[model samples]
Target chain A: MLTKRIIPCLDIKNGRTVKGVNFVDLRDAGDPVELAAIYAAEGADELVFLDITATVEKRKTLIELVKRVAAEINIPFTVGGGISSIADVSALLNAGADKISINSSAVMRPELVSELAGEFGSQCVVVAIDSRFVEGEHIVHVSGGRIATERRTLLWAKEVEERGAGEILLTSMDHDGTKAGFANELTAKVSGSVSIPVIASGGAGNQEHFLDSFTIGLADAALAASIFHFKEVSIPDLKNYLKGYNIPVRIEK
Target chain B: MSVVIVDYNAGNVQSVTYALERLGVSPVLSADPEVIRSADRVIFPGVGEASTAMRFLKERKLDEVIKDLKQPVFGVCLGLQLMCAHSEENNTDCLGIFDVQVKKFEPTLKVPQMGWNNLEHTTGPLFKGIEADSYVYYVHSYYAETSEYTIATTDYVNTFSAALNKDNFYALQAHPEKSGKVGERILQNFLDIK
Candidate 1:
């Protein structure tokens, strides 16, 4: 009977919140701390802060930002991007993040997922997969969707779950920034294949898309950026809409 | 006054500290018996294998110290599991504060019942203004069956105790620290209790 979560992902660059189209043309959303507090108050089930510049900068702003956001909001927040080592995961957790998300690093070194999960528990480690449709198959994308690996989405997700990843954040690069709807087919494939919680991301335009992602995608949570950042769809409005559709949601007091 | 959180290789201590700080309560992380006993309240949070964690606790004599504490104590996730008489996890004996055994979830349902779950049957001051059937986040495979100490119940594949209370000892299977406002309100209720 766990409530279906409504999450808003904030892509951070240079300590500022930014959202872009297809991971480019970045625009300033606002201060991460401010935006995180707003989302928490507005009934967001959780928050995801991805330091988009972590690899290029060779440093992570997520830990400090997580510390600041954790000081303000009383909800679960996940920090991801440029998490390459156990030290990085430890730092983010110490900074107050409830979960640490790893993308390219985890893909490159699959053992890192199990190692961290073994040390910190699987519940704290989230394996984020950026997948793109290629030649009629979902191929795993790395380096922030710049490079496509030979592995298929379902194959890698299964491996990560076997290696002890507690949750999977599946974002479809083709659907990202499209504002159409989630990759329901791909999500359902992964959700049906893995027992871990699957958070569906990318291509969420309206409330119907959210509903589709849950009912059809079979996702435990639906995560979006543009719709939430631009105020095209508020968390409460979305939650009310989902409730009307028989999806269990936690209404704000 | 700062609450002391015992860090004996358990999980979620940092999140608990973070949640307390967000509530305007500063909490200090410590494993020293003196620090824990001196604090206004003590929080015991854990994750990972129960037997291994119990080994860490027993080695530090924390098991004895934690049992002898007079201040209010709160256990989260595996911390709650370890406070029981025994756990199916690694077949380890626990602190016996709750006199119950923690059993693994039925294999029929998915292992590690992750994500947000609703607390259906609830009571005690910890629930306070929180409505029955409120949702809280959970991630675990083992669960404590209903017992005399159970204060809240949640349903997944089946109904199980989500929260337990006995005297000054309180434990929650779900991560209240990560459960958002309902969780924050529960934390505030615990802080307000005499």
Candidate 2:
């Protein structure tokens, strides 16, 4: 019996957790390793550390950070952002990441998905689709939503699966910072079309939002940043809440 | 007294290495037959396609080395699939350690069984203190059919062997290294095997 996954994403800039992270424990709480451990203890199903580092030298630091986090947390780990080639995937997987997420590059060269899947297996590849509703339809966005492509969201989802991607991380740009809820409407369209697991990311404000993502959106996993990062919603409390709704989740004993 | 993680072209060996290190066991990650056979326990972990990985193993004759290993051998994910008689992953024949066939999960239910899932119908020492329905993480599309080697079973579209036990060779579809406490406990139980 597979349970719904709750993934807390940590955005790393220059090898350290950026934006905001709860320092609930430890002397220096900003470290991704500390945060990963805390999240693991809090019953997070998995952890995603997005390395937002730019430049050649800084990427090396991100790799080192990945190694530290992998050693600290025993749960499934994913590293994303700025991963463009097989070499990058190899480096991260070698550093102990269980999976690697490809966003812009996946949209740029869809073949990269199969290439990574061939080299590292489909289970290790995740194609993250950043989509925004434009002109009455969902359109794929690239370069962190700066430019929109003509690619239809549902079509792209199917393409990635055929190309050998194991999972799809569907993030709604409109709902991302708003926190109103997940794009259940768009998510259902994509999730229904694909056979692989779909992770509903962005716009996770409350427990009900997560419930909707799982039930209405039909997503295998739900991911959020601020909600989990700021301690506004603790994972244990949220999992208990979801369990009350009959959502199958792994609760701490 | 030694534990060695058999390394081929598998992807997620580092996590397995990290998991062992946390248990205070410094495991040697190796593809060499000598290092693998010499160890008290050998963990054959993998996260790749069946045919390609088999080619890598066969190229170096690691396949024979793995099959000849008399020590307690544990296979994970692709390793489990490859240890079976054949796999639908690439219509490739496998090492035949488990005497079962690996089939692709029907797309009607979902391809890869991602996230944390529980193991049921549990038995054997690998499960030990781990209760039935104890949640562990899994990420795989191909699964081994339930057989005499099966120690535990789980269902998605259909019930499959979540964990298998045959003599000294043990294999599970789940990634115990990344499965949190229950996972750690399973690994610890494997380590405690003497």
Candidate 3:
């Protein structure tokens, strides 16, 4: 049985973790490597390091960070944010990142999805779609969700899958940071529509919200940032809760 | 112990090398026939399309070297698929180290079947201290069917070979490097094989 995955997403900037992590034992909360190791030990099925660093040497810093994290953390991690070319993805994968997520680049040139899948295989490509429900229709947003695009969320999701994306990371701008719950209705529609695995991101406030993402949203995996970083919900406890619900989460032995 | 990961333009070799490092063993990545053949343990790691990987392996003559290795040669993911007799992917012929056929999963569920899945009927040195419910990470569209070489099985779209062992060769369909503590222990056990 393939168990539902629980992922901890960390925002990386300048080769360091951007968001303030609240892990007590962490020596340097800014150190993404140490933070990644902690999360891996605590039963994080996977990790996503979204690099928000923008500079001339951004690629160098990200590759170095990826090498360090890969050497320390045993679980698979995905590196995303500003990854626009095959050269960038090649360097990161060579540095030992298991998967790479692409956003605006895919929207700007959708051919990139097919090219990446053809060159590196679809298993390594993850297409992240930031979406918001606008005027009774879900619209795709780019540039960290600050700008809206005419591409419909569901249409883009299907297109990426057809273009050979291995997975879809769908984040809802409406529910993010609300701590209310996930956009289950929208997530469900995408998950049901796409054949590839869908990872529901954003709006994860509580353990139940995580459960809802799986049960109601039909997400294969659920990703959260602040909840796991702030110790609001422990992974083991959440897995246990999901297991009690017969959700088939991975149990540590 | 000289552990060398056979790199034939396949992905995930770095992760496998780092996984060995975590167990206090530093592994060298090499496509050189001498380095791979002379190593005490040769780790064959791969992640990519079958035919493309096969082409590269043949180009470097690593396929012949791998097929002739007497030392413990462990294959991961696509490496495992390439060890078989034939792959439905690209209709390519493999090294025939393991007498099995690699077939694509029916779209009853997800095509790639990505996520963590537990191993069952694990019965080899690679699974020495691994518990029954130990979950390992996997990402692939195709799987090798269970055969006499199968040492372990996992269920997703169907029951497939999670791990395979035949004489000096051992292989795993899942990414042990990314499977956390249980996976680390499995890698350690493979290194401990004598």
DockQ of each: 0.63, 0.83, 0.89
Better DockQ candidate (1, 2): 2
Taking all chains together, each candidate's TM-score versus the true structure is: 0.94, 0.97, 0.98
lDDT, candidate 1, B1-194, per-residue tens: 66888989776576787788878998888999899989888889987899999999999999999998887888888989999999988899999999988999886655678777788779988899998778888889999988989999998777888988888899999988888888888888887766
Task: Go through the candidates in order and give each one's C-alpha lDDT.
Answer: 0.86, 0.88, 0.92
| Candidate 2 lDDT over residue span A1-253, tens digit each | 6899999999989888896776666567667888888889999999898888878887999889988888879898889999999999999988988899999998889889999987887888999999999999899999888899989999999999999999999999999989899999999989999889999998998999999999999999999998888888899999999999999999857
The prediction achieving the highest DockQ against the true structure is: 3
By TM-score, is 1 or 3 better? 3
TM-score of 3: 0.98
- Ordered by TM-score, highest first, the candidates read 3, 2, 1
**Candidate 1, B51: how far from true, in Å?**
1.4
User: What is candidate 1's lDDT per residue for A18-66, written digit by digit as tens?
Assistant: 7442322224346778777778878888899888774545455556677
Superposed on all Cα atoms, model 3 deviates from the true structure by an RMSD in Å of 1.1
**Candidate 3 ranges with C-alpha deviation above 4 Å:** none
Model 3 is docked with a DockQ of 0.89
- lDDT score of model 1? 0.86
Error of 1 at A186 (Å): 1.2
> Which regions of candidate 1 are displaced past 4 Å?
A19-29, A54-60, B107-109
How many pairs in model 2 have backbone atoms within 3 A of each other, for residues 3 or more apart or on separate chains, i.e. clashes? 0
lDDT of 3 at B36: 90
